[model samples]
Target: MIPVIKKRIYLGLLAATMLLFAGALGYIWLTFFQQDGGWLRYITIVAVVAVLACLIVIGLGFAGIVLSLVSEKNITFLNKPMNFTFSLLYPVVMWLGKVFKITQDKIQRSFVEVNNQLVKAKQGKLTPDRLLILLPHCLQERECPNRITTNTENCTRCGRCPVGDLLPLSERYGVHLRIATGGTLAREAVKKLRPRAIVAVACERDLTSGILDCIPLPVLGVTNDRPHGPCFNTYVDPDAVEKAILFFIQGGEGNVFHVSAN
Candidate 1:
């Protein structure tokens, strides 16, 4: 199953690469090389919008979300106009995260975690607290490896891994946190935990499905810090995840992680 998901991601990337190369070549062929205007005609309109949203969400972190209420028609949409609208509104909520200094990378990483939640939804799984972490297996620089599969017993609750700090933070105001290897694992973890609210981490590719999967659950999707593609080496921003969790999960105020909805 892991291999299958990997294959899917690989194929998706390869196809995207090929399409980009072909488009570039095709444009050069028709333009300067052929002395023609060229077909600037075709574009990744829908894909572009997805990319744009991803950029705004990640690049600007939640700060760019300040513009979320501008309206879809104001932003230019080629397909899934409704999706574009919803995507645009992310700024408003995410912006709350940025106000708290949740860094863009952390926001993107959270979305990746949410991707895991989506898979849980398909299996009818539920989570217990508001904070759900679908983190990569690797540890932060000098940090111990996450033991999600092993009950986090080795966790020591040292307050190192974001979850370590999260345990106290969540407990302080009643929030929950879970870590999973990937999307499928995340969903399963969430289902078993069954939290009432959710503050999730994931990437754009995973966000759409993950956020949508937890219907009726108020979920705030935060992106991760993977400059490279997802894999065993991906890194997550614990600070950002914590901040979002503090906001949406506990409604806490005035902390390094506190973010307002206004």
Candidate 2:
């Protein structure tokens, strides 16, 4: 398994991350102390500080998300928002890690252990045919920045996406890739698909849910490469996608690689 935080590296990153918040505090202090020095100056300082604080909050949230990507560890619990819900709030459910001191490394190891169970299931140890794959349309035309969702009408089955590639693999392996519309759709779709194993692909956004929703059903996350943006000209790491399929179908012989934001 890939080392999750490389303790030393994360120590440094943790420090850098704290600085963003610190900057916000320090700026507020400096401005608050200087208030009444000038109306224009006070307004300028506060405005800048407010904007900086907004950015810091976002930076902190994104940093946390990237942290999730670094470690595929099982995050069993989460938290309610701090009363300031905004863009992509549900993903913030992971902030419980901060209070819980969750280690990303252990989470990754846990996933491997779970997948190993599925591997055992594949060895005639259990004859289970049900298998579900989450194929979030993290795909787009090679040159176009349009994200294509699952539609026989739109995709044209041109094989331009992992979804396209997954179609034939599903036919050959008898597995289904649920092209979910969103996190909610993915959750419901998985319930209906009800496979014995799951091979899920998503941006880091839906990964943990993809893993958690299919409890005991061995789920693997494949974060698609984002040369542009989410769903916009995006592509699943083909190697990762294929390996997930292979690992699910072929057992111990198949490789299950780790997700890395670095």
Candidate closest to the true structure, highest TM-score = 2
Residue range 1-262, candidate 2, lDDT tens digits: 5434333332333334445455766776676656666676767677677757655555554444334334543222211111121123322322433444655433333333333332333332112256676676546466533344444335546655555555555555556656666788777776676666667776654665555555445666666677876666567765566566666665533344543211
Error of 1 at 239 (Å): 2.8
* Residue 199 lDDT (model 1): 68
Stretches > 4 Å off in candidate 1: 1-146, 157-168, 227-229, 250-262
Native-structure RMSD, model 1: 13.9
**lDDT scores of the candidates, listed in order:** 0.46, 0.51
> What is the Å distance of residue 192 in model 1 from its true position?
2.7
What would the TM-scores of all predictions be? 0.42, 0.48
Of the candidates shown, which would achieve the greatest lDDT relative to the real structure?
A: 2
Candidate 1's residue-wise lDDT over 92-178, tens digit each?
435544655655545544434433332222212232353465543433223466454556545666644444544454445455555
User: In candidate 1, how many clashes are counted?
Assistant: 35
TM-score computed on alpha carbons, candidate 2: 0.48
